[model samples]
Target: MHHFFSMMFSLLAIIGHVSGQPAKGGSERNIDRPYRSELTVSNGMYWGSWGYKSMCPIGRYAAGFSLKVESPVGRDDDTALNGIRLHCIDRSTGSSDSYDYTTIESDVGSWGVWTDIKWCYSGYLTAFQLKVESSQGNGDDTAANNIKFTCTGGYYLQGDGTNWGKWGNWSPTCMGKGICGIKTRIEAPQGKGDDTTLNDVRMFCCD
Candidate 1:
């Protein structure tokens, strides 16, 4: 009888411990997403490099991102990259988690400042979209064209770009579940006639 009681106590203790801890696998991730600033420009038609502008190694959903453009001649609107927005949902329920922008730049010809990083409403960032344009005359110009998102269940949202290329369709699924983190790829800036473009964005899986 004593041994039976001890076993019951142990089981209860284990259950309590499990319940006190965070639930993994399909649950929300509690990781940090850091932002980085970068610039890329091209001098000729299509000559530049693509690398990370910002990255968060820990597993976290891509709530959203802020874009920064450099234009030697004009403002943010006159740059090649315009702005970006998010389209996401609750990871567990799959319900729409829409977000509204409050600090959008007014001028369409010049990117004033780095717009605020927009995030998801209910769940981790699960998907995204982009807005881009062709490089202006002969000026050192650059823009962040696309972005990605990671979820809890290994699911992801990804996209890419080409010189003056139009926006593509959103990715169906990164892995299978939710978003974790993101890495922004960029093109290096060149002298005048820079035609830089954000090539692609990749998502990282959580541990």
Candidate 2:
């Protein structure tokens, strides 16, 4: 009787293993489908921005801007931004498109500022402009502080790098149907006895 019971148990074990194979295969297929869906959603949008600031003056100073961008996670990971352009506006001259900075593709983390010291022939730059274009439809949105800078020349410089140059007294120049100008003031360096003066600086942007 014992020998008979052992043989029955072995036969039952074999049958159970055969039946479980199909269920395991089905579960694997189901698990793969949802993972692919999540990947698709994560790769939809691209994010980035340009942060600006002013530097000390030593006869000439080239300011720099920082950029942060995120590529799609998975689906269109191969897709890349074409490039970014930087421009400077001169309000005094009423001339737009003062300078053209470098261009680069989408990067993972925050990139250092695009300094005028490196690109400027001399350490001289009046204002800045920035614009970002991407291959994707819903490219990204920039932050307001994206264009912050120090008060060196007694005025604030703000504009789309073209159309509007610099302005003074914190007033609007290209007010109607044109690019809006940014207002600024020059802060007298510490320990220097001078009154705070406000002035208008030129605008700049990337293409």
Candidate 3:
């Protein structure tokens, strides 16, 4: 009887996978992903590979982040923004200087240098907006160039990104508490073709 039940359970698991249902660790898109909200922007461009989802440790949430940006080099291939990294903290701790906090980021492009981290000073990150340039047609194209985040403390923080694109609409506010995970789309270096490093992004919120 035990063997029969075990076989049935295994068969059920296989059936779930075959039927394209969400598995134990993740959905059809990634593994070890965190709880996500539907809060996202509609202005992201399409030109890169989607990266893996990266989540903060449980009980922590994003309060700040930094940008990876390449300074403009005249007459050179310019990829404005390359990546974003989230700095997480435990709001319950109250002591913000603790060494136990964690940092998280998804895939990033190969250019640019990481900048100093920015923080909310009082609360966690709740929503975000992006600045993206449209297709240049024949000139240098830098897709996503800058970003801004809204904090739970009712303030906004901006990244130290390059200036090239127009700001888009903000994403929906977090449904739970604040953002806790991230995923990005980045184009690999095209060697000689126009390269628009960082493209689109998605943030996951947690309670």
Candidate 4:
């Protein structure tokens, strides 16, 4: 009778184990899903009188960034934009950090193309700073006026105090259609104070 009870207990344990096992297709259905997120654009500042604005609003949840350089129609031939960098947010820790990218300022009349996108090692991009030169408004004057970012989902909480570019005085309102883009107004070739020739323009997206 003792042996019989022991065998019955062992049989019951086997049945429980078999019943607890996953179904034939259960493992496939239980696989984890891939991560996904959306982009959020934030309007940066319009610093200085001739501050340039980005082509697209920098996404708050920026995965990467690019810079824009211009060679004004009637200004210096030597000066131009070189490169750009970014400040990223470590989403896991909610901390801010910086990433840099520089270019060779060798070409002449070469309106520098957008630099390759630089991704955050850990998180998304939040803010940006520029490398500019004001040759007292001299000839061949070049400076950076605009920047853009590639963004992902939930990068910035609304009013979470993420940094945007500088915001200068608002431009005159559009006559009929709403303002959807920006353009810089430079003090080109000015030979006195700062010759901020690469005046900046920005886009104004309406919510």
TM-scores for every candidate against the unseen true structure: 0.42, 0.20, 0.82, 0.30
Higher-lDDT candidate among 3 and 4? 3
**What tens digits encode model 2's per-residue C-alpha lDDT throughout 1-207?**
113343355346435533543121122111111110000111112332222222111111122222222232333222112112222222333322334222211111121122222222222233333222223234322111123232234344332221111222221222111121111222211122211111112332211
Q: lDDT of candidate 3?
A: 0.78
Tens-digit per-residue lDDT, 1-207, candidate 1: 113343355346435533562222334323344322221223122323433222232333344444543333333222344323222233344433333211111112122233345444444544444434445456443444434443334454443322343444454343423444444444432223343444344444332
Which sections of candidate 4 miss by over 4 Å? 1-60, 69-76, 82-110, 145-207
**What is the clash count of model 2?**
22
TM-score head-to-head 1 vs 3, winner: 3
Provide backbone clash counts, one per model: 19, 22, 0, 15
Give the per-residue lDDT digits (tens) of candidate 4, residues 116-172. 445554544333323333333334334444443322332321211112124233222
Q: In model 3, which residue pairs have backbone atoms overlapping below 3 Å?
A: none
Quote the positional error of residue 94 for candidate 3 in Å. Answer: 2.4
Assess candidate 3 and give its TM-score to the true structure.
0.82
TM-score between candidate 2 and the true structure: 0.20
What's model 2's lDDT at 135?
Answer: 31
User: In candidate 2, which residue ranges exceed 4 Å CA deviation?
Assistant: 1-54, 57-60, 63-117, 133-207
The candidate maximizing lDDT is 3
lDDT of each: 0.36, 0.23, 0.78, 0.31
